[model samples]
Structure formats: structure tokens, C-alpha cells
Target: MVFYLTNLLALLAVFVILGLSFNLLMGYAGLFSIAHGAFFGLGAYTCGMLMRDAGWGFLLAVVAAFALSGVVGLILGLGSWRVTDIYLVILTLAFQVAVVGLFANLDITGGSGGLVGIPSPSVFGVELASPFRIVGLAWVLCAVVAVIVYYVVRSPYGRVLKTIREDEIAARSLGKRTASAKTGAFVLSSALAGVAGALFAVHLQFISPAEFGLGRSIEVLSLTIIGGLAAYWGPFIGAAVVVIIPQALTFLELPNSLVGALNGMAFSLLVLILLRFRPQGLLGRRSEAPVGDGGGRFAPAEGPEPAPSSAVEVRPASTATVSRDGGAPHSVTAAGAPPIEQPPPGDGATGPQGRKVRTLRCENISIAFDGLQAVSDVTLQLRPQQITGLVGPNGAGKTTLFNVLSGLLSPDEGRVLFGDDDVTNIAFDKRARRGVVRSFQDMRLFEGMSVRDNLLAALTPTAHEWIVPIGLGGGLRRPRAARADRRESADQLIDYLGLHDHGDTLARNLAYAEQKLLMIGRLLATGADCYLLDEPMSGLDQSGRDRVLRLLRDTVEAGATICLVEHSLDVVREACSSVAFLSDGCLIAEGPTEEITGDRELAAMYFGT
Candidate 1:
């Protein structure tokens, strides 16, 4: 009985590792890859082959298994980069089936006859053949894995992964290569799964294709989901329950056919019950759930509106000139009035590298969705160091054009020139790195993270700056100096944006206007040269609008370019230096704000002159 208990403990440890590995992708990264079992099989096969056929040592074989599985995971991740949700599920499911078939068919994998004689590992020449010793070894490995996972999730790169999981579009705007992040998650998770496979093979002293199949993958996934997706203790708790409960059933001495069926039925029922009552899992915090606490899906929290007395009104110019160079000094009018705020003294004046990033030229850019043209032959030369408003009626292709410029959508026609370079085909993350950043209409902040973390993540170094350690350590091993610098930057930005009091607050908990401010703070953290803001001033009251307008002017004075898409024409007339009017996928007019706003025909098209 003692020996049986030891073996059971060892098996439980192996499942813990597998559960953690699968959770890294499904829980943390929100990637639902069903090919984890295939990775496990690959590892078992690789380790078994190396040890038995090549006369390799146990440790060497395990390492080889990890590498081989990681390679396959990378390939699969790259292939499924564009697919998501149910489609991604199907894709990975197909890959898993293909791998199992290969294992069953291939002579090298021992065909239908399972590979046997997988040798047990030893530490410092001490044999671990006994069940107790095997259990000890497994627990030690599990402890190490736990430490590694803890540190990785707390690291900067892990923050990026969380952001991607929450909102990939926001992550890309902040210069995170989400596709690469997902691929890295797969590699790490699969490599760890490989480690589990190696342990399993050694413990059982045998391996078969049937042992690592769809059934095993489903079991692992259920373990994670039932425990909690975002909690650290979730996998361990889940694995314990999953491994122990089934083993306990053996005491019942049920019929062989009924045992397997009973186990499967129990798991299915547990999953259904948990999903119905606790969708976020047992250990998950209420805030960690995607939906709100009261069982409603994202019904926003309310807060006090900005007081009327705090508003800073801008003055409209009667005779604003159209100029590429610095504009003439204009005056501010009454507080909280419909007045255009003048470009404080030298708004368009160059600073440091003058005119270097002054213009973003979109030439004949066009895109169609299912034969319906979204943005047709739209062209604009946008100048820097000033706020340029993109104004048009609903469905005028304003946001569509913004998407094209920001690299969210590739145009079928024309080129996007940032100065002399043709950056039309660059990916969204790449475009962001090159100082072209955008904000979404929905304001996609990482709702799961704290407001401070959202700002800090934006300042996290690009992947190139991260130096991998000699071991398989991830971003946590990055240089301390760099991490400290980023943290300092985050603190400074938070204070600058007046979000110091709410620094520790979860982003979703913030009021609507505060959330908008947080997003703008995130944009500032990206250090982008051009800011494409979509409906930034939406949901803001008079004072909030004034604060944002002031922020925009300050940013322009500091030499950053701004292109804003707004529904409020009064705001366009008051805050923008110039305006581009679009009508039905076409640029109807582009010039000084005063010129476009005063045009009778354009006014008729927009507000029925």
C-alpha cells in the first residue's frame, strides 16, 4: 500500500507539471491550443528513443525531448497565428490527431507495440528506481517549475502576454509583437509539457501513442478551467483533485468498462457545473473574471461627472491661416464655451530634429470588405506637431482609414509613406515601434491589470533588449538596471497624468473618464511620434474635454503629431489646427480648420447647411 501511494504521488506530480504547462497558454495567454498532448507524445517518444536506441543518459534525453517538442510547438503556433476562438480549437485538434496517427503508424515510434525500457533517472549517481525516490525527484522538479512560472508571470514579458490576452489590438498599439508573444507562450508551455512527458515515460517505464491523445489533453484543460485560469494555485488544486479522485475510484472495485466511463462522466459533469456557477473557476478573484461581479457581461461601473467649474474653454479663430510652418499666436476665449483654442504661441514650431517626422502621407489607400468598399482612394498628407482632426459623417470611412494607417488593416491599393519609407505593409506592432501608435474607439486597456501595470507594460523594453540567460530562464532574468528604468518611467507617467491616487486600481474599476486618461497615458508611454486617437473625447463632460484638449496642446508643443477622429464638430473647430472631411469613403476637403468648418457645401453634407 505504501509503494502504491508513492507511485500515485509521483503520478500526481507529473500531472501537476502538465496542468501548469497547459495553463500557461490556455489560462494566462488565452490561447486554446488542443495540441498539448501531441507535444507530450513527442517528448515521450524523443526521450524514449534517445535513451533506449542511442544509449543517452536520462538528463540529456529529457533536454532533447524539450527542444524537439518546442520546435513542433513553434511551427504550430506560427501556422495558427491568424486563427482564433473555435477555429483555433479545430486547427489544434486536427494537429493533435495527425501527430497521434504518426506515432501509431511510424516504425521508429515502435508502431502499435509501445516503447518500453525507459530508464529511471538518478541524482549524483544515486539511483531513483524506488517509488519513494521517484516521488521525491518528481516533487523537486515540480517545485522548480513552480518557482520558474511564478517569476515569469511577474516579469515584464508576462505583463505583455497578459495585455495580449486581454486585448491584442491594444498590445500592438503599445509596440508588443502579439504574434511573437503567443508563439513564445506556446514554446514555453510545450517545452514544459515535454518535461512532464519525459517524467511520465520514466515513471511508467513504458510509452504508447494511446497514452498521449485527445483524452489526455481534455483532462489537462479541465484541470485548469475548473481550478481557475488566472490564479497561481489553480493548477495544483485542479491536478490534485483530478488525479486523486479517479485513483480513489479504484477502491470501489467497479467493472473495468464502468471505471473509465465513470471517470469521464464525472469530469464532464464537474465541468458543466463549474462553468454554470463559477465560470471564472474556484480560486479566481472576482475582478479577474471577464464579466462583472453580478453575473452581467461588462456592464460598466458609474462615477461622478466632471464639475462644470473646472473646464478650460478654447477660442475659435476668425482668420486662421493654412501653413506647413509654425502658426501665428492665437487667443483663448471664455471658460466652458464653444471657442477654438489658439495654438499657444509656437505650437507647430519644430524641436530638436525639425521636420524629420513632420508628415504621414497616405497615397490612394483603398480597402474593401466582401466587395463593399470601406475606404476608397482616400489620400491625405498629415503634418506633425499639431492636432489634425479627421471629421466626417457616420460610415464616411474615417475609422476604416485610421485602421489602414495604423496597420490594423492592409489596404488593397496605395502606399503609406512615413517620410521617405514605404511602411504600408508593416505589421501593427512594427508600425507602433516606428512611432506610429493608435488608440481604439473602445479604449482597450488591459482590464485585468492595475492602471500602473498598464502604463508600465507600455514602457517595457522591446524583445530585442531582453538577453536570455545561459539557462532556459525567460524575461525575469533581464538586466535589473533596465527593469528599474522602466519602473521609474511608469511612475513618472502616472504622476504626470494625475493618476497617482489610482495607481493600484484595476483598470476596469476606473471611471469612464479615468479610463480614457489611462489610455492616453499608455499612448504617451509608447513614445510614439504620431498619435491616432479614435473618439478620445467621447463620454467626457465639459471639464474632461477641457483637460484632454489641454493635454493635446501640451503634446503638440512637445513635438508629437496628433490625428484625432471625433464626432463633435465644435471640438474640431476649437482644438484642431487643421481638418480633413470625408464623405462616403472619399476625402471631400482638407485644409485649415477654419476653412473646412466654414465651407457651406461640406457643412450641408455634414449638418444640412
Candidate 2:
């Protein structure tokens, strides 16, 4: 009985690690890979071959197995950049099938018969022949993996993965290298799964291609879904239940054929029940479904309750309320100009320590999609420390132009110049690093994270650290200087945006107005020289509009260039120093706000004559 118990525990340990590995991709990175089982088999075969043919030690074999699987994982990760969603699923599935075929047909893999006589692992010439000792080894390794997982998910790097999972476009806009992050995560997951496979090969003394099929992949996937996606104990609970059910069936003395069929059926039934009843799984949070019912409109929840009329509203910090660095706060009176925040020295287009501010120029840029022109030969120059509103009709391609400037989309013709240098070929993330940042009209805050985390993620110095290993200054080594900077910056944005009350709340839970502000705060965290705001005034109440306007004015006054896309002519007339109008993807007029607004033909086209 004890021996049987140890065997079951060992199986549980193996499956637990497998489930966690899969969860790292599916749950954390939101990448549903179908090729995990192939990597597992590769690890097993590599270890088995090393031990049986080359007579390598167990520790060395295990390391080689991990590296072997990781190499394939890195290759696949790079390939995944070209595909996404259902296409990615198909791509991985095809690779997995190919791997199986290779394993079945290759002579080195022992053909279809599979590798046999894989020896049990030994430590220091002492064989772990006892089932209890094997179980102990498996569980210890499982515990180590669990601890690693715990740290990985909670670290800033883990937060970036979650951010990628939530919204890849948003992650890119904020300077995250989504492709590299995804690739790194896949490699790490594959290495861990390889470890599990090596343990399985040693314990079983053999490995068959049949054991690493699509069905096995499905089984591991089920472990995570049935337990939970983002929770630590989810894999253990799922593995425990899955391992025990087959053993329980043995007590019934069923026929071998029936037992195999029943085991598959049992897991299928459990998965179906869990998904139908609790799609978020046992430990995951329940997300509200999008309210898109037939008609193409999303009925998002309404904004937060209105502030009480009697409540004292805190005004935005301005030149009067706060000093630049360490100067006396100026006083304000009725009928005076609103307080504006002074630009920090050594920031924005300006050189470090209050040097000259640089200009960003778009030189006759044009882009098309499938022969349909989106943005046509448009040329514009954004002056230093000015708010230039890009206004046009619905299909004038305002956002497309913004995308070109921010490096989200490359123009088919022409170049973008920052100061004297042409940055037309720069990648989106690099552009962000070079101080060209943007805010989405959708307000793409990393929804599952706190407002503070959303801001912290924009601090590029620590954002890339997610891929580093724990001991090598990954999540384990918290750089006090970098962390302190992020915290200090995040706090300033929180206070500036009046998000102090909701700093700790998940971004998704915030009101729409707050979410929009949070997005602006995230852009602020980047300390960009130029800000491309999609729609700064849409959906905002009078107070909300005022707050955003104040923030924008303050940002510009602080030596940043802003190109805002807005539909509100009143806002453009009131706040913008200049306006650029577009009609049918053509730049019709651009000049002082009054000159653009006073053009009769432009007004007629803008109002749809």
C-alpha cells in the first residue's frame, strides 16, 4: 500500500510541474501553446539517449535535456511573432504533430517502438531504486519549481507578462518588447517542462512517443484550466485530482481497454463541467463578459457616481501650488491664468539641464492598406512645447497618422524626423525609448494590475528586467535605485492625476474617467518628449475635461510637444495654439487655431457639406 502511495505521489509531482509549466504560457502570458508535449518528449528522449548510449551522469543529462528543449522553444518563440490567436494555435499544433512524426520515425529515437532500458537516476553512486526516494526527489523538485513560479508571477517581470496577456498592443505602445518577452517566457516554460520529462523518463525506466501525444498535451492543459490559470496551488489541485481518479478506477477492477477509455472520459467530463460552471476556474477571478449583444456596440458599465456638489474639489497642481525643483510657490487670484506645472529640468525635447527643446517633423508621409490609401502624402511639423490639435472628419485617418509618428505603423513613403535625425525605420518600442510615446483612445491600462503598477510598467529601466533570472537581478534582486525611481515617479503621477484614492485598486475597477487619466499617467511615466493623445476630451464630463486640459497644458508648459486628436472644436479653439485639419486623408489646412477654424471650406468639409 505504501509503495502504491509513493508511486501515485511521484505521478502527482510530475504532473504538477507539467501543469505549472503550461500555465506560465497560457495563464501568465496568455499564449496557448499546443507544442508543449513535443518539448516534453524531446527532453525525455534527450535524457534517455544521454544516459543509455553516452553513459552521462543524471545531473548532466537533466541539464542537457533542459537546454535541448529550450533551444526548440526559442525557435518557436521567434516564429510566433508572425502569428497570433487561432493561427498561432494551428501553427503550434502543426509543429507538435511534426515532432511526433520525427520521434516515431527517427532511428535515434528507436523508431515507433520508442526508447527502452532508460536507467534509474543515481546520486553519488547511490541508486534511488526505492519508490519513496524517487517520490522525495520528485516532490523536492516540484517544490523548487513552485517557489520559482511564485517569484516569477509576483515580480515586475511577471506583471509585464500579465500586461502582455491582457493587451499586446498596449504593451507595445508602452515600450515593452512583446516578442522578446513572449519568447523568453516560452523558453523558460519549456526548460521547466523538460525537467519534468527527465524525471518521468528516469522513474519509468523508459519513454514512448505514445506517452507524449496531443492527448497528453490536452491532459496537461486540462490540469491548468480545471484548477485555475494564474494561481499557484491550481496545478497541484488539478494534478492531484487527475492522478487520483485513475487509481480510484483500478479499485473497480475494470478491463484494461475500458480503464483507458474511462480515464479520458473522466477528465473530459470534469473539464467540461468546470468550464461551463466556472470559466475562470477554481482560484481565478471572474471577469465580466463584454456586453456586445448582436448590435456592434459595447455597453460598458457607466462612469462612477458623481462627486457631491458640496465636496471640496482639489485643483490640479500648477506653477502657483508647487515650485519647480525648489522655488517659492507662486500665488493665484481670481481671473488669473490657471496654475501650470513647470517642466522638470533635463526632460522632454529639451536637453538635460534646461537646454534647447527639439522639434518632431513628419515629412510627406503616406500609408495604405490593401490598395486603399489611409494616410496620404501628409507633412506636418510639431514645434517644441506646443499643443497642436489634429482635427478632421470620421475617416480622415487621424489615428493612422498618429500611428506613423509613434512607430506603431510604418509609412510606405516618406520619413519622420526627430530634431536632425531621421527615425522613420525605428521600431515602435525603440521610438518609445527615444521619447516618442502615445496614449490609446481605448485607454489601454493593464486592466488586471493596480493603477500604480500600470504607471510603474512604463519605467523602461525595470520593465526589461522581467526576463532576467532570479539570482542574476531578475525579480529576486530588487534594484533599490531603480525601484525607488519608479515608486517616486509613480507616486507623483498618482497625485498629479488625482488617482491617490484608487492607487491600489486594479485598473479595470476604476471608472472610465479614471481609466483615461490612468492611461495619461502611464504616458507621463515614460517622460516622453512628444505625446500623441488620441482623444483627450471624449467621454469626459465638464470637470473631467477640465482636469485633462489642465494636465495637457501643464505637460506642454513643461517642455513637451503634444499632438492631440479631438472632435471637439470648442476644445481646439480654447486650448490649442494651432490646429491641423484633414479631409479624406489629405491635409487641407494647418496654422494658428483661428486661421484653421475660420477656413469656410475646411469647416464645411469638417461638418460634412
Candidate 3:
């Protein structure tokens, strides 16, 4: 009984490692790879071959297994750069099959006969020869892995993984190397799985191709889902349940074949029931309801609604006078806050010469989709410290032009210049790093994160966003001063955007206007010099519009260039100094806002008279 119990505990420990490592991809990074079992098999074979052929020690063999698995995982992760979702699922599934087949055919791996005589591991010359010793060793390693995973999930790097899971595009737009992050997650997760595999081989003293197969992959995934995704104790709870269930079934005195079938049915039934009733799993958190959902956690407290007109009014603690680039002073007050006090110029606000800013210019830029021109021969320039409006009718190529300028799409015909440098070939994230950023019409905020966290995620050059630094220094590697500054900046932005009270609220929980403000806050956090805003004032009330206009004015005054894409001519006239109008993928008119709006022919075209 003692030996049986020890064996069960060791097996549980191995599965726990599998569960935690797999969660890094599926739960944290939102990647679903079915090749985890194949990686396990790779590790087992690699370790077994090395120890048997090369006479390597247990520790050295495990390290070799980890390195080999990591390299293979890196190759698979690179594939993720090209495909995702169902296509990625298919890719991994194919890989799993191929790897299992290779294991069954490779002579070096002992082929169908499988590898045998994997020696038990030793610590400092003390052989872990007994089941009790092996259990203790396995659990110790399991505890270490758990601790490592705990730190990783709690670190800034983990936050980036979650951000990628939530919205990869938004993360990329904020200058995150999302592909690299995903690749790193893959390599680390696979390496850990390899460690588990090595442990499994040593514990059993044998490894068969049958042990690591599609069913094993499904079993790992099942345990993770059953325990809870993104929960710390989830793997432990899940592995325990999975191990205990099959053992418990033995008490029924069923035949061996019947026991296997019944166990599979039990797990499948449990998964179905949990998915229907408790989708988040036993330890997973329930999704928070959006605000105004009948007094949900994020709902506004029971109180009289504030007057709509006063919603955007700033309520600073004290009044102050501020100016930008020695410009005219603006009175910043608390009550009835008419003019907002512009904060100090950000790093991207001005060039070396004060108030000098880089201009974004597109020359003869054209692009087409499905043989239909979306933007045709558009030549435009957005000058520094000014708000330029890109106005157009529906399907007029305004958004297409924005996409080209922001590097989301490359123009078929011409060059994009940022000041003197041509940035036509730069990636969108690279362009963002060069101080050009944009906001989406759909307001792609990280809905799972709080408003403050949204802004923090957008803050560039984060110190501990890489695995190496984070693993080496742990929490101390996160520069405290830099983190504090980012937090302070996030707080100031929350207040500036009139979202002070909603800083802790999830982005999805905010009202429509508030969510819009948070989007702008995220843009500001990127510290970009040029902003391309798409329908920023759309669906906003007068007060909300007023707040955005004021913020734009402040940003322009601080020496940043802006391009506003707006449908409302009134808003364009009120907020923009220059306007470029597009109609049917063509640049119909361009010049000062007053000149363009005053033209009767252009007015007719705009109003469709």
C-alpha cells in the first residue's frame, strides 16, 4: 500500500507539471497546442537515449531534454507568427501525429518495443532507489516548478502574455513584440514539460510510445480545464482529481478493460457537466458583468445620476495656471473646469529643438483589395502641432489611408515618410515605437483589465517584460522607480480623461463614453508624437466631445501632430485646422478646414446634394 501510494503521488506530481506548463500556453497566452504530449515524448526519448548511450547522469540528461524540447518548441512557436486559431490547432494536431509516428518508427527510440532500463535519479550521489525516495524527489521538483510558475504569472512578463491573450493587435499597437512574447512562452512551457517527462521516465524506469499520445494530450488539457485556467492552485487541484478518480474506480472491482473505458467516460462526463454549469472551472473566476447590469460589482452605486453636462467637468483639488512651449497661459480650475491644465510635455511631444516635431507625410499612396482600389493616389501631409482632419463618406478610403499611415497595411504605390525618413516597410509595432500611434474606431481596449492596467500595459520600454530578466531577478528585477512612475502616470491619465473614479474598473465595465476616454488614455500612454484617431468623437454627447476637443488642443499645444478621422463636418470644422476629404477611394479636396467647408461644390459632394 505504501509503495502504491508513493507511485500515485509521483505520477500526480508529473501530471501537475504538465498541467501548469500547458496552462502557460492555453490559459495565459491563449494558445491551444495539442503537441504537448509529443514534446513530452521527445523529452523522454532524448533523456533515455542520452543516459543509455552516452552514460549521462540524470541531471545532465534532464537538461539535455529541456534544451532539445525548447528548440523544437521554438520552431513551432515561429509557425504561430503566420497562423492562429483553428489553423494553429490543425498545425499542432498534425505535429502531434507526426511526432508520435516518429517515436513508434525510430530505431534509436527503441521503436514499437519502447525504451527500458531508465535508471533512477540520484541527488549528490544519494540514489533515489525506493518509491518513497522518488516520491519525495518528484514532489520537491514539483514544488520548485510551481514556485517558478507562480512568479512568472505574477510578473510583468505574465501581464504581457495575458494582454496578448486578450487582444494581440492592441498589444502590438502598443509596441509589444507579441510574436517574441508568444515564442518565449512556448519555449519555456515546452522546456518545463520536458523536465516533467524526464522525471516520468526516471520514476517508471521505462517509457513507451503509447504513454505520450493524443489521448495523453487530451488528458492534460482536461485536467487543466477541470481545475481552472489562470488559477495558481488550479493544476494541483486538477491533477489530484484526475489521479484520484482512476484509483477510486478500482474499488468497484471492475475488469481492467472496463476500468479504462469507465475512467474515460467519467472524465468526459465531468468535463461536459462542468463546461455547461461552471465553465470557468472549480477555481476559476467568473467573468465580471459589465457595468449597469442590475447592480453588478462594477455597477454605479445607487445614487442620483449627475447632470450630463457636468460629466466631463474636471474637479481638480486646486486651480493652477499652465502653458506649453511658452505659449499663452491657461487657467486650470476645479469647478466648472472650462480649460484643462496641460501636463508637462511628454518625451514624444517635441524634438531636440523645443516645439519642433516630425511630420507624417504620405506621397501618392494607393492600395487595393480584391481588385477594388480602397485608396488611390492620395498625397497628404500632417504638420506638427496641428490637428488635420481626414473626412470622407462611407467606403471613401479614409480608414484605408489611416491603415497605410499606421503601418497596418502597405500601400501598393508610394512611400510613407516620417520627417526625412521613409517608414514604408516598417512594421506597425515598429512605427509605434518610432512615435506614431493610432486609436481604433471599435476602441480595442483590453476588456479583461482595469482602466489603470490598460494604460500601464501601453507604457513602453517596460523593464521586466522579458523572461530572462524576470527569471534572473524575480520581483526585484522590476525596477521599482520606473514602475512607480508608470503607475503615477497612469493615475494622472485616468484623472485627465475624467476616469479617476473608474481606474480600478474593468474596461468592459465602463460606460461607452468612459470606455472611449480609456482608449484615448491608452494612446496617450504610448507617448507617441503623431496620433491618428478614428472617429474619436463619434457617439459622444456634447460634453464628451468637448472633453476630447480640449484634450486634443492640449496635445497639439504640447507639439504633437494629430490626424482626426471624423464623419461629422461640424466636428471637423470645430476641431481641425486642415481637412482632406475623400470620396470613393479618391482625394476629392484638401486644404484649410474653412476653405474646404466653404466651397459650395465640395459641400454638395459632402452632403450628397
**Which of the numbered candidates is closest to the native, going by highest lDDT?**
3
Question: What TM-score number comes out for model 3?
Answer: 0.90
| Rank by TM-score (best first) | 3, 2, 1
TM value for model 1: 0.87
Give the least accurate 10-residue stretch of model 3, judged by summed lDDT.
318-327
**lDDT for every model?**
0.76, 0.77, 0.80
Candidate 2 — which residues are off by over 4 angstroms? 287-356, 369-373, 460-463, 470-473
For each predicted model, how many residue pairs clash, with residues at least 3 apart or on different chains? 8, 2, 0
Q: Higher-lDDT candidate among 2 and 3?
A: 3
RMSD of each: 6.4, 5.2, 4.8
**What TM-score does each of the candidates earn?**
0.87, 0.88, 0.90
Model 2 root-mean-square deviation: 5.2
Prediction 3 global C-alpha lDDT: 0.80
Q: Which 10 residues in a row give candidate 1 its minimum summed lDDT?
A: 318-327
